[model samples]
Target: MKKIIITVVVILIFAIIAIYCKFILGLASQMANPKVSTLEKEMSWEKEHKLWGDYDDYEKEDYIVKGLNDYDLHVTLVKNPIPSDKYVIISHGFKSNRYGAVKYVDSYIDLGFNCIIYDMRDHGENAKATVSLGQFESEDLYKLIEDTYNRYGNIKLGLHGESMGAATSLMLLAKKPKVDFVVADCGFDNLYDLIHTSYSVAKVGFVLPSVNTAMKLRYGYDMKKTSPKDALVGNEVPVCFIHGEADTFILPENSQVNKAATEGYSELHLVPNAAHAQSREVLGKAEYRGIIGDFLNNIDFK
Candidate 1:
């Protein structure tokens, strides 16, 4: 009987270690090497949808900045010739590059706001290859905002982000940067909750808590600290939350909770029948552009 009990204990210990290594450490590595969409596929989609109409014809500049822990970030500046003091820094989603901002670029340009689109670390042209979810990504945003302020000098600034980028934008709010408005599209509320929901369908929910603990101990990433819902609480910055009603990946309720947590200072726009970041594409250019334009115009930013 004693031998049987000892054998069971050994098996449980081994299982714990296996779960930690496989789900925790392995998951982090997988996130760092997400499958990126090819240029051909991106161009085909753009052509079919007429997204970013004539974006190639615009004048652009290449900008680079150093992020936290010496990580390098690659950025593209889309110039607006209207000579306005308004500017926007747009951050793309997980596993996506600055090219993902194609749908929103033309509208911002038409609205006379010069746009800056950049790649997050571990994705696109950025030299570094690591995913902190949003812990370090927020630091990258700080550097970008600071550089933009230095270059433009006290201009009206807007911060916009999608998915993981949206989380980073919200996380940055904890520091209260000098920006007129924020647009977070399809952002998750809590990193840990998001991970749990993503893996629950795969029957991996039992291992996720252990995985998060392992990530904290081994990788120094406290997943619980990366909550956008918590960040939005009492945040005075004018925020516009855009999400799809059919979004199961991150869920529409997360945005609803975030908007509610903002103490009635934020606006929530749910696009019917849209999924993930497909609000713009699904709503067609006119309606989507109108929503964004109205939000920007109401902000009273020049």
Candidate 2:
């Protein structure tokens, strides 16, 4: 009887250890190697250059900024045809590069705002190996915002991001960078919640709890503490959130909840038949341009 009890206890301990190891490995792989879908590859601007004629006509200056942990981030500063102090920092989504932000540049430029599009760590030319999701990326954004202020001096700033980029922008609110407004497109509310929803009940039972712990142990960042929901709550900045009603990847509900958390200062726009980051295209050129233009016009920039 004693031997049987000891054997059962040992088996349970080994099972727990095995579960922890598997969870940690899976979480690490997800963060390190984000897979880009075939549809997303086809969505690149290089493949659709004709859609944005004269995109090459604009002059872009290459800039480098240092992140919180000394990670060097590459940036392309796209000055408007006519110089203006009004600027917008464009952040692209997960598993994407600065080109992912190219589509939105025209709208801001049309509004007479200069654009700063940067590659988040691990996604573009940056040397970082691990994706912090939005943890360190948010800090990188804050640094870029600060660098913009220090370089340009007293400029009206706005932030715009898509998907993970949007979540990073939302997280940036906690840093309290001096800015005019924010535009978040198809952003998730919380990192853990997003991951949790993406997995099955069986996976979540073991994997969800160790995700943050593994992140902290291996990557040295706490995943649970970083979220757009935490940043947007009671945030005084006027924010405009756009999401595709047809999006199931992150779901449009994330935006709805985030908009609700903004306490009446934010505007939410839902585009029909669009799936994640396809709002501008699905809304058609004229309507999309009008909606963005109106939002920018309403902001009382300094």
Candidate 3:
């Protein structure tokens, strides 16, 4: 009887270990390398979701920018007819392509800023690579900012980002890019807490630390350090934080925390009845445009 009990306990211990190993590996791979939506699908998604913008109507040119690790980033230059020195670089969300930024183009153009948009790494037409949430992504955005400065020669610049792009923009602030302002929409404050919440919502929160460990081993970035809020500690650049009041995916508190974290001039606007990445849609074009225009004007983001 004693031997049988010992055998049973050993089997149970091995089974638990095996299950834990599998879960950690799967989670590390899944989060670090999610399947993204195709560019064509994202355009159709924007239309189906009633997002308004005509990418073809703009006079734009395409080119490439080398990012961190010499990774090539596909970029677009959409010009305003007036030809001004003010520029805004718009970054789309994770799983979305550069075209997803079209919805905001009209607003920027209306505000008299030329629009620059691009496909983030591992999204759209870019080559496949591990997603480090905001670590490498922030570096990539900084590269784009530098390239813009080199090409334009003394221009006022602003950054506009959605979801992951928002996080990227905020994270890059730690590097102190030379820019006028940042408009972040529906971004997460921390990758660790975000993913932990995801796991908790699925009833597996306890596994996150192990998974994070696996992530560091499999991919070379630490998940716990990917906090956009933490990045703003010493930043002085003006940031406009926008979020949907009803955003449950990332929650509006992400923007709230960001506004609180920034030592610089900041504004937090919550769009009523909007979900994740749906602030502009819910606020309508005029209201959405107004929020950004007012923020820029307030900061004299010329």
**Backbone collision count in every prediction?**
0, 0, 0
* Candidate 1 residue lDDT tens string, 160-236: 88899889998899888898889999999898888888889988888787777767776678778888889877789
Candidate 3 residue lDDT tens string, 1-302: 99999999999999999998997898888767778888788788878867747557779889999998999999999998798999999989977889798889888988898999999989888999888878999999999999999999989999999999999999999999898999999999999999888889999999888888888888988888999999999999999999998998999988999889999999999888998999888887789999999998899766
In angstroms, how far off is 185's CA in candidate 3? 0.5
* Prediction RMSDs, each to the true structure: 2.7, 3.3, 1.8
lDDT against true structure, model 2: 0.81
TM-score of each: 0.90, 0.87, 0.95
Task: Estimate every model's Cα lDDT from 0 to 1.
Answer: 0.83, 0.81, 0.90
Mark the 10 consecutive residues where model 1 has the least summed lDDT. Answer: 31-40
Per-residue lDDT tens digits for candidate 2, residues 1-302, read 99999999999999999987986778677875665433245345534643353446788899899877778999999889998989999998888888778788777787788989988888677774678778788898988888999999988889999999999999988877788899999999987787777765445645677667878887777767768988887788989999999998889999998888885367889999999788977776567767777787676544
**Cα lDDT for residue 107, candidate 3:** 86
Better structure of 2 and 3 per TM-score: 3
Superposed by TM-score, candidate 3 places the C-alpha of residue 96 at a distance from the truth, in angstroms, of 1.5
Query: Which prediction has more favorable TM-score, 1 or 2?
Result: 1
Give the clash total for candidate 2: 0
| Candidate 3 overall lDDT versus native | 0.90
Ranking by TM-score: 3, 1, 2
CA error at residue 235 for candidate 1, angstroms? 0.7
Native-to-model Cα distance after best TM-score fit, residue 52 in candidate 1, in Å: 3.5
